[model samples]
Target chain A: MKQIFLCKDRLIFPWVRPIWVFLPLFILIMLPTWASEILSVSGFGTLGYQADNRSDVATIRDLSQRPKDGYATGPTWRLDSRLGVQIESRPDPRVDLVVQGLAYDHYKANLNNTITLAYAALRPTVNWNIRLGRLGYDAFLMADYRNVGYAYPWVRPPTEFYGWIPIFSVDGADAAYHFSGSDGIWSLKAQGGKSQVWMPINGGIGGGYHFKTDNLATLSASWQSASWRVKGAYSRFTSASDIPLLAPLQAGLAQVASANLPATSAQAADLLQHVSLEGARISYTTLGATYDDNTWLIQAEMGHTTATADIVPQGNMGYASLGRHFGAWMPFFTFSTYRPKSALNDTAYDLGATLNQGLRDPSVYMANSTRIDQHTLSVGVRWDFTPRAAFKVQLDTMRSHAPGCGLRSISPTLRTQDIHLNQLTATVDFIF
Target chain B: MRPLLTLLCCLGVCSVAMVQPTQAEVDVIVSPENPLRTVTASEVSDLYLGRTRSITEGGVSVAIRPYDMVDGLVRDAFFMNLNGMQINQVNAYWARLRFSGEVLQPSHLPDAQAMLDTVSHDHNAMGYVDATLVNDCVKILLRLGGGAHVPPSP
Candidate 1:
């Protein structure tokens, strides 16, 4: 993947604008005549709106988006809106070529993030599949398909589980072995690759961070019956976080450590590790299951992520949802939560109090910088009004616990506590 | 009592849904060159759901090319017989697999006659159509229904 700056304003392909979407649609109609045997084109999009609410903190769809207003000015459409087009060419039974370009509120308005997926697969035999190129991660249950709103029940997948971890696509290779028997179908997949992503900072006040993950590896297995599926995956990756906002803190810690003061030497060293995210190793393990009996849909997933760096918080997140279909309408309910393994580091606070005067403490904010805790209860309904389209409206009541503001972009001014806020969101999703 | 009431309401909806418009019998037809004489519903459903690309028939793994029709009624009836699924569930199921592009969906033809034309030309190709329309060009691998379903004629 090419390195793109978080503030790079230049479009990689200036001429490839939104108008170019029509060019493919025109080509799709004429394609059957030109290369009907090998070519296929399809697309999906969501027109969404987040209803206004009084939020003490700046709410974001995920870590990848920066809402325009830092203070809950009004309703936002870019929070949950996206359009994607996929082109697949299968010239032979054993070969597959796919390129999908998605347009969303990416951290960087660049083509690298716009063109999300481009991969090729080759089937050596009936039971073996080998793929290479830029592929979506198959770590979670809906990690790859979450962008396609029409494919899932909710307006968006639970943000607690997906917001903090934004590495969606990896540029590398994977192999899968599939076999089926009288009981069920089973598959084993192994993936290894490198990935780069820019996650947003403090909404509009702070910018974003461009981080790269090296030696990313994942192993996943699944067993599927006619109406039930169980999947589990384990992944490990190492990332170095170079945050410009925390540069002052890092330098301060380094200065204190270098001085070798007896009282603050160990504290400085530990706080330096807390402030710097260099050579951070993160491991994510997840287990998920789904049961869709054509009449009822039930899904649940639990994930635990651990990191070696104190700056990178270790945590657990999970969600369970149930939905039932009645003709063209489906009503659903979901509960999701995220709990950090450890609260704010007392060592950072102790060193910060030591650095600052005992009266006003900036280290208190430092202690609360990465601490996030929250749980949400959601009720939603989906109306499949047409064959190719669906309209969904969901109401989510969130409780942002004290000492943390969940996954919101963080700052001293926007730090909210133990407050409840209700958000209403609606989306019309379609695929063609 | 509340749980039972909820279950009763769900059963009532199911009972109402069971009353659907009658259609014709859909025959899962494949090329006569295919080695397998017949297939089970799960085997056919697996292909339709984009689960497996090939199946072992007569001790040999044979790659399959499934064909779908533009006629919505016959298509719905076929899946309804294969698995108790409506068209929306089927479409959403395929949509979930669309991003990976790992699962190969059955190519869509204009109508059943076009399906027959394509299936007859390829030994691996298979399709479903009105049982009355079956001819010597393709052999019946499975039968999905016995309704009076009339598909778009050639």
Candidate 2:
């Protein structure tokens, strides 16, 4: 596998490089013929400045932490700034091709995280359609357009729920069926594909990590009416990661097995395997609803994730938001929380007390490091000063009981202490 | 003297009413060739919001292509009364769908005349216009505010 160094520092596998290169070239070559009738170009972007009064680290969802460019001590533009471009060509009434690219600082630079959506759609019938290629993950209500800041009311979706799955694009095919009834429009979607997931790891010996999923499946249904929408989705994927710190632990367990300490070795192996990040099957289920009657906006989403591999914690997360429109100005409030089921316990290891302590400490630390019990409350105001643009200012205050587990930018001293952060972000979002 | 005071008050009221501009009534219109002569407010809302892509009438499915009169009181009033959403909210919804490649926004025309031309030419196209601009080429599907009525076609 070829690796691409990005963010001017990190290493990543370039799995979608070929598609990225070929798709744009194909569109450019065909642009002349389609320019007059079928080609349509559209875009949305956000320019933001954020300042946090707690830790110096700023986390963008779960992508990466901006340590070098801190949002905590001072304002940073790279934290929330992003741009996306989309090109759609519909040569026939039943067929269309869409390609979109996004540029943001997600531990990468120079458009490394581009190509968010690239798919060819076929409307076989009036009520059914199929899409093939790289499509947006539909695991949640806003999963498809989560990166488009202008689409959603919040400056950003609640990080606790939206941050769990970092992979947003799946390379595969999906089928959708639509039905219209007296109530509203209902749609059912099922997608199956694989994805390359890049998750930023903090408070670990290894500074960074990358994950890959071979089998990914998602099913979702939604009903939208004039004033209300309800949606439900479920997704499952098997993930594996490459982290350097776990190599020595694996070696130590193998050595114990060779020394004829079967009982001790078996216990150690179980502990180590449970905490490893390889070959883990993870599943996510979510239900959400939104009500927007032009004057009032109400949204709520709740999700639960279960992992077969113990390295990933089983947890539940949710958020509820309310907003009211006052002419061109809208004021909103949101409350979000994430809680893990149980802490890691390694009392079953039967090795000698000293050896057991040595092995158990690392495993317990690894498990505890992933635990997150946090709550965040946010208040914001959005001003639609123009038809195509909006200016927003938001204030967020978060408290994490699990410290480093829930909050990024965990300092050495604050790793064990409760973490509290207050952040202010102001942004201008526009579509063209 | 009482009659003179009453006459002065009437004159003052008439002048004030004359100075205030009345809001124009917006009318939703479709092509004359369309099979469905009239549309309910809910159906119009569904079509414009990308909720229902097609309308089945007389066992035939006619795909809908909704057009908008760009940036005006008529467009604002149409969306506000149809879905209770402002133009910004509607634009945001379309932006999400457009970027996700799910659906496209309605085609935007410069003014009511342009919308009239589009809806009049395409049988599947529907748009809104001021009632005064409604002509013989287009048929009124629904009336939004205070608007003149289209003469019954023979």
Candidate 3:
């Protein structure tokens, strides 16, 4: 009884403090400048509809059906969009404040109703600036500007490539100091913080563990010259495992003992298992570069991760994109891939087994552990209908492959042969 | 008599074009503090584009005050030299940074007077108005190397 209350106390209350901290800052920045400032409000949204011709590939449900090529699958996914407002104290150069709200169905499923981004920045000297409260990382390319359509050439980032490591933004504090010389210009940024997240797998044997990490850091540098510009960044994520939920896996007899309990009592017994929660380590690294001139922008990135937790499957991913701009529009294309070093375990259950028989083979109870590869091709365009706003549309074709599973009922046939999935999306993004 | 009047009108227009300010004077007016010691066209482009970030000695923040879209010289010199990115792209760049809670847009001025006010207050701020409106408040950093702007005065 005490434990449940403690979980709620530890997890639930800490997140709410930031919201309270943010609201007053918004009013404080706006209250003084209301008369002279421009209350600029803007928003963007994507009404995405996708159809899966093959049920075994990228379907939200009924993965075992393996429907025929022409089968009709209902378009099942959608997103609730986002909007923000910035109160610009125009003629006064030093201070400006922004408040934004983002809502997506997937995030909301875990009771994350309104993701708020609010902050105040003081640029005392143009070369040196410091911002505090709910700041996001200035990651390579996609990490920083996922929303603005005009900044990117593609409709959306290639999912097959980026889907491997899914942490999008960080909430923290960041500072930048700039230096310029005859040879080139250089800038540096230092940022650190923690974020609340939901992983696809739990920390135990089946998937990922539920907890937050402490070691998050990013260091970035850039040099600019007449003909070209170069930049690179490195970031790390380290998790400390202390959750009481991970213990049961180490006790062989505990599994047998739990099997004998009534279903309801078994649930209580499972909470007693905490072995896997002990000292699991996790981290990842990223690097990127970009060069652009009058006609083109070329960019690339490579990233890798090492994790002690079984939930995080470690691997490497890389991508390259090229784009060109026309008068009011631009078109571009990209190619990228994700390669997993080892497969995650697959779990299956056997109803026919005796109480002592335990679960069937590990593969039957957990996800299949095998090598997987993902390849993607994307093409898209941006149209600027107005000076401050633009619209973008992009489409991608992805193929994922695993080895040796041809079952129509038990597996995604991509294991036997490459499976194809298509995504089409349109975004209306703007700034004031 | 009619022919004479017509000739006078053509001469008036031609003289206006010829008297357009040179690139050096424009440079002095854009950023008054920085000395104009034979800077290259590339240097001018870098200053306005926000890419170079600093000047001859140190890394200085490049302040840009974008004029209304219809402002011909602002579009030609700023956007053309920066990255060939249209106004939407520039706006998007600031927006992305803004949404990320990184930085706000560089100070925006509605007209030449306001731009001059900003430039006069900060040595790092760089902007442009009519060549005829040049003043002692700000030094001309560099003249935009393009057709719309007049060449610099010797």
Candidate 4:
């Protein structure tokens, strides 16, 4: 009993947990003093819902809320809201300081807490700006701040492209520079640091653990003309866990149940080492266009990503939307889709190789290696009741399908079953 | 009844003829030294909406201020001809710009006299008021495309 107590005590460390809560507050309290001169505050939020057609799994129409599969037996969708305030201080004619705070709900099985976006930035020239702290990752065209509902033409972005990469916020440093072109404005950005990311929850027993990274780097460029905007970005990412070792062990387990091979500990350990998938290098490109004319507003976007590792499937996604303005109301509709590549081989393995043929062992299968297609259709309305305020309502219905061969052949029934889900959301957005 | 109606028509004509013809006219003005003689309605709309910053003879920056929301003369002579955007839509556009720190609302002028002072002082200024108030201080560039300017009554 004494040995057991010491063993547990050695692994526990409670002192480090409080620092995460106290550090951000200490910095926030210090801000209103030295930096209080030209402080300007701004805010944005979205309140929405999702209704799934399948009973076993509820569709997540709203990306802001917790997926039902990830939470306990509670409401399938609740008020997924976000609110942020930012301050901009210009001490001199040539220099300015910016600090921002963002809070949101992260619904887990038995957890409800608001994540904060604590970041600061400085700008000394019209062409150069630098920022540091817990901020957003530099993706192709989306601004983390501007990604709120008030800024976009649709209730949500097409899940096909924006949903594929899954990495959202970066807690690091970023710098950008802008130049002029005959066609429009051109800008370049480079960011690197430890990034915090979350992916869509998997329905399997154990899924979607909070993904953390130590080193993440990205380079991006954007150009905007009168009615068109295009952007391209590349990112290199690495994580603490090695994924290649997990895939084969899962495949081996699947084969043992069907092929009557004995499950041994040594066999599982060997397959884990041979099939470990880890450390991804990903590249992304995105293009968007909008026509703001007399009677209608139309927008379209397309994006694609290729990754070196099989952890994230290489794919392309896009959407098209149109909005018509009447006297006091603007009604719009959109459709978006995502497609994943069908193959997953690391250039060293063949279909009939020693590793591929050992499915009866406990270490050669991955659940997400197969090809899948997801699409969503949404209709929404925006009512500009006053000059400073607007109300929006949107409905999205989603459907997903997977191919029937290769890895999917290992579980034909699970691969062939297509599921449908729906989400409905409403928001009152304002700017002061 | 027919005879009575004819008598009233005659009486109306007599009154109209006896009264001095209050001459009502409309004109568009710019700087006297500006080389350009004419511009399209779309160009005026762009300037007023703050969509474009420069015009042919205008400087890099331009300021557009409607006389007032209550002014019938300004609406008939200027805004209606450019685009059908009502007063509310323009207000919404300005609100969006202000929050984004893009642009500010144009300065408002009270009457034709004040408007004349503004346009005459700044070469980039554009506005419309009573045509009868036009004087040598500013140059009238384009006549109102249509007829008599009684301006719609409130």
Candidate 5:
């Protein structure tokens, strides 16, 4: 890429950087009241650290964000540390405007992804709500509100369940209807949108990139009884942007096909077609249930995602946790697992074997990045030390049953045989 | 350093006081003009936890508002007897719902006097206060701990 300099360009709109334009606006979140009725501000944050016994691979809260390269050794604060501030304006009983800006470990350099929720909604009635803007992506049970550390019992949501979802927010609208059912209260929500998210990658593989999804539609329903809540949701989406790292490989395949080789040419073309994002589709179906009786809390969810991407395998992931409260303390245990149903196709592997070293390297990285075949056992305790804060510590021991990697970022130097890891984490979560 | 120690000591004492049971039981109350003369502890739980914002009155649905007295022994005892939930747990539950853009939280009043005043003025408002503070302006909905409270004459 090259650029030509001009005198007019230097003098016009000099402050075009994204950070400066939004810095002052974000500072206003510190003031909690603008005459109290029309405006209110609230926020949550966590001061956390993770101590790792095995550094063969790095740990990430989720694929959406990753820490710096060397932060995974011994102890690191970048994994679970985050701050989110939300400002809400309610001018009338039927209208509201909410904007939440979250600061976390981001893979992008710009401010576009920081604002998680910016929506203006119409509450025509107490039981109905419609909103159009950037809404939180409620892909799973706790995915939308996971940033609020004071809300949940564990130090964090189970990694195997929430790790694959990078969708922080979606650009679109949703309408929800709430009503009293014979058994309990029920709410149904339908949403549609287009979304784009920046994803992190190992520098050894490729630079961080952003991908877009179109025709994104989701339908979810939940019912709450006295102490039980059960919810189910299904969503479908199509990839609107190709993986940037795939461009080089696609180019290589095209070059080889153009040479008119008989067997390799057809394989190259077929593999090329399967790897495209033009019409690639993905769908997810998830179910979750929880029971909380003001003393014992139980939560579990299961989700299965099927996608057309050749590099990514379809799989099921779920976790269940049970905790009992004794005065101010809650001790819990969780078991989570992810199992892939299919592996790389024989044709793609054959092609990779015959291809040159340059093309083969990135293909391996792409395949590895999407792999998941692991289970984890975690034991944690949360102590509500104050009215608005809690202290929690967790120990996670994970083992992979196959060569495929778990949902965390892996160093290129990691060996497949070294598939066991034990990590310890502690955090103090607060809300204001 | 002395001041810091004193502050820590004060916080510890306040936390201990928050858990200790109070001798005076709180009473749930509503406006005298409001249609709801009595409600169960579970119904009050649902109202305060933000499960339902309206109650059925005279075969017609009537909107109701629930108010909370600012954090204190009254608020603490009300929650402790309502469902045995601590103030922190209740706050956490509301935080989850509030930030999720689901249900609006109960308005907070400065003190029992203010809560009584607000509820008595608004036909749709419901609140709880000290039993000894009740009067004819507000009617007793449900006595929390089976204690008898006589309303003062107008």
Candidate 6:
């Protein structure tokens, strides 16, 4: 007896309408034709459990809202459980199509299934290839299949470097050239596109930020030999976001500007101008290397980000891990760090006792919160129990020297104090 | 009764010996029509791993199709000597590349005869088999481990 009204249209259980519409359309698209063989279906999934002994909140990665309660406090399946399926059709030697869909808990509120990638690949020559559609970012190592746990060594890639750019896919095109030599193979790739970013806020209580990129361009090169690989990439993008939390700071700046306070208003205005999210440009450069000779594995990556916006702090992050394989078991240890260029300097906005504390406090807090100085040490073990499956256990200990900065989850009790979080995670990853 | 027990033990040992055949030498092979007669271990590894799909000889680029034994000790010994990697590691590597649309794993044949038949019929096809199974239809390019008896040319 329930009726849903959307505009002038009426429907029953409006949430179910999307399922009805897309399911049939998906089936129709998957049906085989004379030119296309049966659709090639492949999938990857992870079953994970984690526990943290520090705060009630679990900090999986940066951009995760705090104080909403942590999954590490209990046995939770929603933290890292995800499944992805990819369907590919190759009608000819020169052309192919692929569509991938992912179902994950952290996609966004009210959305559990989304199309992660849909692209058409064209090979004009044996050594050159082009792809158009929603494509994975080619900026960093493992960027293409970061979520597929079976492909990587870590239960999750070191969050220190991986969390810098949250956006994963770009809606555009890319071209790659491959060169083979006597000793190795080298590749150069260039991609350009725009993307939308969804960042969780307010401990994921239906609060988040949505950002749109004006344009993103990336160029990367990689060379791989029998036992060694090296990669480097550079990317730049301009983005704009309407974050509601910053509205108060903007209003305070305007108030002071109109109140005839020349000196205070000028400083506040400069701060506001730098922190504004409109048309802010961010550039990142990264280099990575790995050496794996079956028995030993060594990997290291360093990346630096330069941001024109004050709210987006400039920083460098890197990690190095060394692992050795002994039969079916591989054990590794890693060290990672994130250091922000801007320290917690709020003295510019102190503005003396003449100004209202309201105006000064918000500005000072915003500037101070941008400082991040943290390091993590982790050790893990991986057991390849089956041909297509692996079981991994990792222990990560993170220390935030800047207090409530970096990957630390800020609680009311730990706001002004340096914090350390210890987390242990176990995951079973499989690909089929 | 004692005589019968001894006979049963002897039969058991004989069956175990038959089932567990000694590891044999694996021979890299190609069709009799193939022009190339010699290949190195590294070249074979490159062709089988899909690192290079074709090789050039005498101004002609010949596309190579590789076939692998599905489950056998010879396949294991072949890969171990060529790349020092286990079958699982190779499978994992292929899986990682397959999902990205990068490279496809070689076709798998059930036994030595199937591999020999496929390689014998296609000039561009290449495979490995127990050296003892090599016949006049295919030409041996290289031998791995211990060499097997070669049949007389037709």
What Cα-based lDDT does every candidate model obtain? 0.75, 0.74, 0.51, 0.51, 0.74, 0.69
Chain B alone: TM-score in each candidate? Answer: 0.77, 0.75, 0.53, 0.60, 0.82, 0.75
Q: Give the C-alpha miss distance for residue B122 in model 4, angstroms.
A: 19
How well is each residue in A1-432 modelled by candidate 1, as lDDT tens digits? 123632231264222222234335434543563455567778889999986467445567766777676545367788889999997777668777777888988677777777666766889888898987778887888887888899889999987777777677877788999899648889899998777777766675677788777678999998888999899999998784567777777787788778887857676666666556656788999999999987899999999998766557568999999999887688999999888876654544454454754311433455456666788899999877665678899999877675655676545654645757788999999888
Best candidate (score: DockQ): 5
Cα lDDT tens digits for candidate 5, A1-432: 112322442255232222334335434642444666657678888899998776557777776766566324457887889998888876665676777788987677456688777676787776888986777776677777887778898878888888777566777788988887865778899988767787765622467667777678999998886688888999888876776767878788778767788776776665665556545788888999999887899999999988776555468999999999876678999999888776554435345455835554455545544678888999999877677888899999988754455666666555254478899999989888
Which pairs, if any, clash in model 6?
none
Best candidate according to lDDT: 1
lDDT for position A394 in model 6 = 92
lDDT of 3 by residue, A1-432 (tens): 646954775586453335466657667767767666555555543433444355543332111122222122334433213344444343255555666665443311232324445656677765876766565656454665554434555654554444444344455667888766657667788877655454322111233334454446778776666545566777766654443433433344356545675553353233222123334455556676666653677778777766554434456777888878665566878888777666542222222344224332332223232233666787877666556545567677766666422111224323556667776656665554
> Which digits, one per residue and each the tens of the lDDT, describe model 6 over residues A1-432?
112323322153232223335434544655653245435677888898877776454575435322336322354555566788887766555566677777666535333126666676787766777987767778887666767778767788887887546566676788988777748878889998776656654354436677666468999998887777798999998874656777777787767766666587776666676556666888889999989898999999999998776667568989999999775568999999888776545676655575536666666556556556778899999776655677789999988765334554454345456778888889988877
Error of 5 at A320 (Å): 0.8
A297 Cα displacement, candidate 4 (Å): 2.0
Instruction: Provide the interface RMSD of candidate 6 in angstroms, 1 decimal place.
Output: 8.1
Between prediction 2 and prediction 3, which has the larger lDDT? 2
What are the per-residue Cα lDDT tens digits for candidate 3 across B1-154?
Answer: 9998896566445434322333322332545664433445555555544544344524333454332223234543455543444455556555655566555545456666777776787655566665557677866544553444344655
Which runs in model 2 stand beyond 4 Å of their true positions?
A: A1-33, A56-59, A69-73, A110-112, A203-206, A254-260, A348-350, B1-22, B147-154
The CA lDDT at A289 in model 6 is 95
DockQ of each: 0.28, 0.25, 0.23, 0.05, 0.40, 0.15
Query: Which prediction has more favorable lDDT, 4 or 5?
Result: 5
Q: Model 6: number of clashes?
A: 0
Q: Of the pair 3 and 6, which is ahead by lDDT?
A: 6
TM-scores of all models? 0.87, 0.87, 0.71, 0.61, 0.86, 0.80
DockQ-based CAPRI category assigned to the predicted complex of candidate 2: acceptable
Cα lDDT tens digits, model 4, A1-432, are 746843663355221122264346535654664554444455555554434344454333222334444422233334445555545544433333444454554433221123334444555454566765555656645535333555554545555556444455566677877655654566688987665444333322334445555457888887654444566777776653443335545565435334534443344333333334344455666666666553687877777776654445557778888988764467999888777765433333332346456542222234343344777788988765544345677887767775411111122344446656566767665544
DockQ of candidate 4 (2 decimals): 0.05
The second chain of candidate 5 has a TM-score of: 0.82
DockQ ranking, best first? 5, 1, 2, 3, 6, 4
Ranking by TM-score: 1, 2, 5, 6, 3, 4
Off by over 4 Å in 5: A1-33, A70-72, A203-205, A254-266, A277-279, A347-365, B1-24, B146-154
